[model samples]
Target: MTRTPETPLPSPKECRRLREAQSLSQADVAAALGVTRATVRSWEKGRTTPRGTKRDAYARLLTGAEEVTPHQENPAPALVGAATGPVQASPDRAEPAPEPPSETSSASELAPRPAPELDPDPARGPEPELGSGLSPEAEPLSPSLTPDQAFDALYAFCAPALVRQTYLLTGRRELARESVERAFQLAWHRWPEVAMDRDPAGWVRATAHEFALSPWHRLRPRHRNPEPPPAAPADRALLDVLLQLPPVYRRTLLLYDGVGLDLPETAAETEASTPAAANRLLHAREAVVTRLPELAEPKELHRRLAEVASAERLRAAKPTTVRWGGEQRARHWTRAAIAFTVVLIGATTLTLRTAPDHYEPPLAPGATVYGVPPRVAPGPLSAEELALRAKLKGETVSGPERLVPEAG
Candidate 1:
């Protein structure tokens, strides 16, 4: 019996493109395929191939073909889970038997389905245009505020807790506010670049922590009374407990508890390795407990710290202004540019007006000169040579016209 052809498996690049085109993340595809995310990544990277049941499933997924149900006669599930040592695979197998041949199935139903054609019919409608759009003035209004949308959204999400995290680090309300503001200012300046990072908030928090810990504030003369604003009655006891901890331990605890960063992020902000950060967080908790015997366990300390930090209050609060300051910067640059241009034009005009006129020969054909001479000069020639040159043009002839020089 003639075997049915399988759906053509996609190339590695095509596989990745199809997955992304379907709006599926690698993790999403991995979950669907019952494989590790690294396996999916390797497939996309051409480090390995999806084969056996995996290829069939991938094809079915991408092509929207009928999935091989659990009850199917020839189910080949979890091929990726096994035979995963290498990318090589056996030759393509025939498409599996159709739906176990239902009682109402016609003879034609068992035959392989043809691949779908991509191009639309000529008569259906005009071919879709590419790079086509209405004019800038005529185009429909775009979704509101495209500029820095991702960064703006991120800032909106993280600013409050970041400020709180800084406050916890510095123990000074105004300094915390200033540090957070300075960090956000840097973030705004590099939003396009930083927004693409996997964890932009980590970077911002790290920067804010640096700002809070900077020694410049110490070098400057300070008033005798430079303590932070008095905490609320509810928070005073908690703040008193936190102030006694060292800066590293305090910042590490605050980063994990107050800002909700993961172990990696906490380590990153504190400039420690993951194991080191974990150790620091443990020691910090132990230190906190040693200071305050009322808190029994480390988890209890974390819970109490979270409550005192008021993460929920900060998370739900209206964000302080997420200003990028691009407009103000643009305005300043515009004024400076205009002033520079005016100066340049004035200098040029003054030079043109006061400078002496230069005698310039006519330009060659199709040549145009602006505020400069057109270079032109005859070759050096004797008066006798000039008379002979005129003779060469038939303006005059001294004697016989020499076709070539007699000697040299």
Candidate 2:
């Protein structure tokens, strides 16, 4: 008997890519392979390898996918920078920096072309842009793109997806929109720093996630009221489970599973150590699984997250609006700070002018005199007392006579 050669499975990333490319969910793949979704998830995540018959089946499936779909070794360049790092300007030139592109229409002009155009390959759809879990919809930041143009492109590309993400974090459409807008506004205010940062999209994402999950948001009158739950029962259940999780856990889960960030990237974004991040991710997954056993697989949870986010119309503000708002806010804060400084200076000056030059010792607290009693004033005499006084005056005499008369 001749032994057939075993089909080799692709790498973990390729396994996920091929499945997503086929528009097949983990459940679908699981059903086809006659395994649980968790098994499929582990295979994609490279936690556990398939063995024997299952291994052969998985290998064959991926091999078929590879044959059917065109392989793209280098999927797409990121919007912000290249694989090496951000493209920097030459230093030797004595020329002044180029004027920033016009703010007006910058967003519309530089906005990334729609999904279908930028990423023609369906397999590359879920691959996230620099820091965001969403695809890089915008063109890469070339030397020709001005700072303003680049910022607008980034905002236009990431804002929509970010809004949806924030909604998942907070379950409030308005708060989600506000969070993304606020994040972009801050990003614009610190354009130089943000532009130079390795992951500009990520910086904005962290800021937005922070803002959306802020406990202070509960104090906002508008945010005090919970947003209406998802219309779909399944979506509602998933969102409820997500909301039940601690903010840190929820954010970790969203970043890792929903955004498709690698473990280290998720850890870095969440500001936790890698081990701690892994622990959080585990707890978060367990929590979700406990609530909704159907979402046992990370891919399934990711799909549900996308579904819940998409069901709501969580639109972000225009890039111009975000930029203008940031500027206005900066101006407002600047003016307030200046005014406060002036007031403080004036108060200090006034104190210096009116104050005594020498140090005046504080007066000692008044002491109580040991023997002295408070003064008691005589009150007006009553009628019977007046009569007694008149009688005593009329009967006045020498001391001995008075004593004898008093005895009589």
Candidate 3:
């Protein structure tokens, strides 16, 4: 029997990691590929798919070979910073500078061949340089980003994809745009919190997704027309297939395959456990593959969606107006204080509300207690008991009311 095939390995996120592992910047890759930095950035950001010769060059540059050939022992450098780790002299010694895509490539000058066999294990592949588990949704944010820089960078880099995702989820352009705007506006005011997050884009994305699903956006005034039907039947069919899946699966699919988050970040954004996210991705793929036979491979679905639904190139995000200091800042903090105070009070009230109503029940009413009292039992009153109490006197009657000798 034929063995099952291994999954395809190159993803936009993986490509970014690959280039970073080699310590090559976008400019470096762009220079080598005869493309613009924007193009290289687009590829890494999943904004555009590399095609034909471009794909060929990108694949080779990432592999640190002339091509992404079928081979083992592909070294994934550890995610240690360049300063901390000793350099691997061999990759540099073995590989020459990435040459400008010819007439042909002269980096080792090998004849280009077809796309290589898919690596079965990406986890075993080359690691990134900065740190482990980096998602495409982030870049290292500098401490110096001004208000404009922060908002613009996030908007330019992430808005197109987010809008596409929100569109898919809400099925309305107006709602999607509204959601994206609202999320970024919130992020702008709280850029400190957002930039510090592991997935700043995810913070905004989740907000937009949640906003899109709100009942308010579903109203007719807030709704807008979806894109016109695709001329291609295949594209049309894919949309229909995507819509048929459950909402959870649909959103999960959009984030994982559609938006380029790894399982963990996807889980965080969707509020799912990692395993649940994985399961949703699996089931979503199964559903899509069932409908679209051409997308039988998970990577095919990944490839299709990673190139955002349209070919639009989005510019930086610009919110309407931002007031940075003075009263604006004071108002922000004051509102925050008020909000915190309210939450504190609400929490205290909740604690009070849920608390048991009854006071520690009063020891039955008029109850009395005695510590293991003087050993007293029947038969006849002991000498001590007789001394302590006389029935006629007001002394305590301790010994079980001395057994009475009646007129026998």
The CA-based lDDT of model 3 is what?
A: 0.53
Q: Which stretches of candidate 2 lie over 4 Å from their true place?
A: 1-138, 359-408
Q: Candidate 2: worst 10 consecutive residues by lDDT?
A: 105-114
Q: Candidate 3: where are CA atoms >4 Å away? A: 1-139, 221-227, 311-408
RMSD of 3: 18.9
Q: Evaluate residue 34 in candidate 3 and report its C-alpha lDDT on the 0 to 100 scale.
A: 40
Per-residue alpha-carbon lDDT of model 3 for 1-408, expressed as tens digits?
112233233888898898889887876675455444555665676644454344655677788975332111112111110100111111111111211222221212111111222332366653221111123344433557675765566565556556655656654555666677777777777766666553455567677778777766446652544556544566567777876888788888776554444344356567776556666776787788777778765456544443234322222234443223323655888999999999999999999999998877556766775575786677887988887666546645563456878896
Better of 1 and 3 by lDDT: 3
Q: Which pairs clash in model 3?
A: 76-126, 76-127
- Please, what is the whole-model Cα lDDT of each candidate in the order they appear? 0.51, 0.63, 0.53
Best by lDDT: 2
Clashing pairs in 2: none
In candidate 1 the C-alpha lDDT for residue 32 amounts to: 54
**Candidate 2 residue lDDT tens string, 1-408:** 112344577889998998787787776665455334555675787654554345655776666642322111112222211211122322221211111222231111111111121222356464333223234343346758887788777776677677778888888888888888888888888888777654566678888889888899778798667777888899898889889999999888877666655454456678775456667777887788888888775445555676677667556777788888899999999999999999999999999999989986665679555577889999999999999898888874843253334454
Regarding TM-score, does 2 or 3 come out ahead?
2
Native-referenced Cα lDDT, model 2? 0.63
